[model samples]
Target chain A: MRLRLRPRDDSYYEMFTDSANNLVIAARLLVELMSDGADREAITEKMRACEHAGDDATHAIMRRLNKGSAPPINREDIYQLASNLDDVMDSMEAAVDLIGLYGLERLPKGIIDQIEVLERAAELTAEAMPRLRHLDDLTRYWIEINQLENQADRIYRKLLARLFSGEYDALTVLKLKDVIEELENAADAFEHVANTVETIVVKNG
Target chain B: MRLRLRPRDDSYYEMFTDSANNLVIAARLLVELMSDGADREAITEKMRACEHAGDDATHAIMRRLNKGSAPPINREDIYQLASNLDDVMDSMEAAVDLIGLYGLERLPKGIIDQIEVLERAAELTAEAMPRLRHLDDLTRYWIEINQLENQADRIYRKLLARLFSGEYDALTVLKLKDVIEELENAADAFEHVANTVETIVVKNG
Candidate 1:
């Protein structure tokens, strides 16, 4: 791949790299939104920014897809890849958006714990993205991503067991569970991306 | 695309379609497993098969990726697409696996309701995958998929509120909530595929 190009001629790697960078920022925003218990309006505004930035990155990939030449891979596949990556941010923002929209102040211990795990997973994902620029190095971070995903799974399981064994009301059990699941799903998406990156290494390398 | 290939060559799509078809069956099995407490071991075995099938499909896509050839779309993008679709099955199977592994023979009404919604979502997804073979018809199912996703979201919200409102024991609440969240995540993945397909249509049309 040539380094010099017109503004619109950036390589596919650049598009995905930008998307990955946005994911890191979104992850950080999520931590701030939850841990700090920001005001509803403020959090919502931040989430909107996150969603917009993520969506813009997705569109950049789509533009590459629709550029009317052979993409590096299948167009539909690229579209899905871009969209799903954006979705990790979309889903996370939605969770935070709801937390604010629902006026959920004083986050629960279960949720806070899940977020901590999620933040760690996001950090791993951010680290993994930079490696994707060099496919050879992808394997290095791939295992770490998987480990983060496994850790997330364990946390999710423990949280559920605690929810069931404790004395909370039925509705509260449901709410906490939703919040935790969304966080887990966001982490799961990161794992999916990791899996995608791993496949790239196995195939392209 | 020319349909000029051996059964072995088409096996990827065949197996892919088969895995999706199994989604509906697995979901129905989930419903029955919930009702027929007598066949726990058998149902567990079947659920494992579903998980394995999903893994196989993921591997098949990776195999295609490793061949150093482009899929119908970009190679990297297709890898991500395949991984994301397989994940729906993986996640759903995990829920069923967990229920049985944890000996959750009897679940609360709310949890069951969420599972029912999940079964419907899976059915819709099963309906959607075959349409992929016909590129032109992909967008037709988007509305139905979006509707099911939205419905699942509503049920998730209502169920969680009930969980937290003090209807069940804390521990039980925890378990049931986890189950519900996994089911919801399964639905979320389907919605994602639908969104991807919709984008394909809008761009291609």
Candidate 2:
């Protein structure tokens, strides 16, 4: 091997990948929440466990950053990246929590559209985290997430209109809206994660 | 002034103060929304105008940061401060917009409690911005805002319990909850702003 100058701290990359992968699992849990006759209580419990896993991943990254073990990127970027990933999981968990709390049964068909967008975004994010080492390919990730966010917004508005269409009673609307809104927030949180990555690339790459 | 070597970009302080001051105005407008026979439409229109003004203030700061002006603090802190302040305004504006969209006739009594907390937080924030120059006195500001946020949370959950207490019909509950949730978000955003300020003081001061 050629003579190396500095030992690169690649653990940060691995930690971030673990965090993003946790989001993917959480997104799939959300998908299961949309399934017909699915055990939502069990799924919500699983989602809670998934969120805990995400918190552990986030805490691991933070502990490493605090150690100041020759950070691969700026401390703040790593903090923001960890926090944003954590935020996505939190939003997803909140959605499940509300679904159970409000006794939300028979979710609208439009909800599938919202959940699908989240699943796609989560998958894309998982794919993009490994590529963080090479920033050039991230432009595509950023563009696609932006587009996915837009799509999620549109689906959200449509759901809003449908809820207000007088088909469902107000209380039912409130419960469903709470669930859908959390998913939308999850999507937005994904975009925030992408933005942090872009910031990292622009500043360091 | 006698031995000044580095010219300080105190304009950042001024811009931040302006933004916080704008939130004060917006919060007061929210108070007016709670008034008996209040011209809510006119108030919402004014709130929209206030949000636009906030946007302008945020853009001015961003433009200044972009021009390579000597930021007294780290550039990221400035960016976060501006964005968090902007988020406060956006959430306030959204509350008003949804109130109008849902044609909320009369709000619950607990809403006044929420508005009062926001107004107080906004005032405290406006007072704190100038003291940013001397990061030492900021402890009171941070402590008070955190207390206020905790207060806001208690008020929110109480209101949620009240909403679900079989008092109002489901439709009204939906409308009021949307408005209340946005206000809660504004309070959380204010805390985010304080966190950024603390970060600045920790790193730079």
**Top lDDT prediction, candidate number:** 2
- Residue-wise lDDT of candidate 2 within A1-205, one digit each (tens)? 1111111246777778878877888888888888888998889888888887888888878777877787778888989999999999999999999988988778889988998999999999989988886665887898899799979976886787678778898667767888888999999999899878866865665
> Model 1: runs farther than 4 Å from truth?
A1-134, A137-205, B1-12, B97-105, B110-113, B161-166
Top-scoring candidate (DockQ): 1
The CA lDDT at A190 in model 2 is 96
All-Cα superposition RMSD per candidate? 8.9, 7.9
lDDT of 1 by residue, A148-179 (tens): 77778777777766665545566666666677
Find the 10 residues in a row with the least total lDDT in model 1 chain A: A1-10
Q: Write down the C-alpha DockQ for each prediction.
A: 0.16, 0.15
Question: What's the number of clashes in each of the models?
Answer: 37, 0
Candidate 2 residues B69-164, lDDT tens each? 677887777878988998999899888878777667778899999999999999999999989877868888999999999999999999999999
lDDT of model 1 at position B81: 53
List runs of model 2 lying over 4 Å from the truth.
A1-71, A79-83, A86-106, A116-131, A134-161, A164-166, A169-175, A198-205, B1-10, B35-70, B134-166, B202-205
